[model samples]
Target: MSASARVIRSAEFQAERAWGALPVAELDGVTVRLHWTDSPYIWHVNDGEEVFVVLDGQVCMKVREQGVEQVHWLQPGDIFHAREGCEHVAHPQGVARVLVVEREGSV
Candidate 1:
């Protein structure tokens, strides 16, 4: 199949609910998505690597290592990378827009 490139205005993006994601593109077996949220996401470990980018607003990323949980503050333009089996979650300060790339069907 052929693919066409287009522009996406992330600042103008919105979703019906918190943590809602808009499908962006698929490369090989990886999926790119735009997520809008005002709430926190559940802790999960991706089966594959994940790239998370904050496009708007702020987010607090919580990561669990060993038995300790750490907090990371993310602002616009900040990027977070989670390797496979890494436990983490994201909590939006208010409203936020994020770009995420991960293996398709991963949790």
Candidate 2:
């Protein structure tokens, strides 16, 4: 991936209540979000650190590994930090826009 950033980390766009998220692409280990609504996105990890920051809407997330899984409620202006090897499912409750940055290593 290139080093130039297209969408800034904290930028929001088009205020609307969306029900699902459409993926944009990956940038420097982070996933560029371009969705209108909130949907559950899964992360199957094998040592990768990720940063999930809401630029417009909130995100509901669930992480599962081995025999453990947990849920979360994320609002706009909220950031979720994830370490490596964490499997998760994320779904926001409203029209949510988020910037997901992940690195190939354990945090």
Candidate 3:
């Protein structure tokens, strides 16, 4: 759904992440979708805010710079975000589902 209206599918966004970068769901204010991957670069943020909703999986979201903020082993409905202008990476130990939201800006 829209941020203030109804849901509108974004044709510019379409991706499936198993072991790669997931595209994104339709978005006007924010984006949403499911994703799963094994990586050391899952939550890398750059000049934008990225929110991740974990559906199922073993994942770690951490700043690749500070190394202080860390989110790991998320499950269904778990949500997290990448700091703006901060780089993040997700290390998934097992397969999982994730809904990522990146607003219509630097992402």
Best by TM-score: 1
lDDT: which is higher, 1 or 2? Answer: 1
Query: Which is the leading candidate under lDDT?
Result: 1
Error of 1 at 22 (Å): 1.1
Model 1 stretches with alpha carbons more than 4 Å out: 1-3
Q: lDDT by residue for model 3 over 20-88, one digit each (tens)? A: 335545667665555556444445455678887765665666665666765455666677766677777
* Sort order, TM-score high to low: 1, 3, 2
lDDT of 1 by residue, 1-100 (tens): 3356678889998999998889999999999999999999999999999999999999999999998999999999999999998999999999999999
| Candidate 2 Cα errors over 4 Å, as ranges | 1-37, 104-107
lDDT of 1: 0.94
Ordered by lDDT, highest first, the candidates read: 1, 2, 3
lDDT of 3: 0.59
Cα RMSD for candidates in order? 2.3, 6.0, 5.9
Collision pairs in model 3: 1-7, 10-26, 42-90, 43-88, 43-90, 44-88, 45-88, 56-96
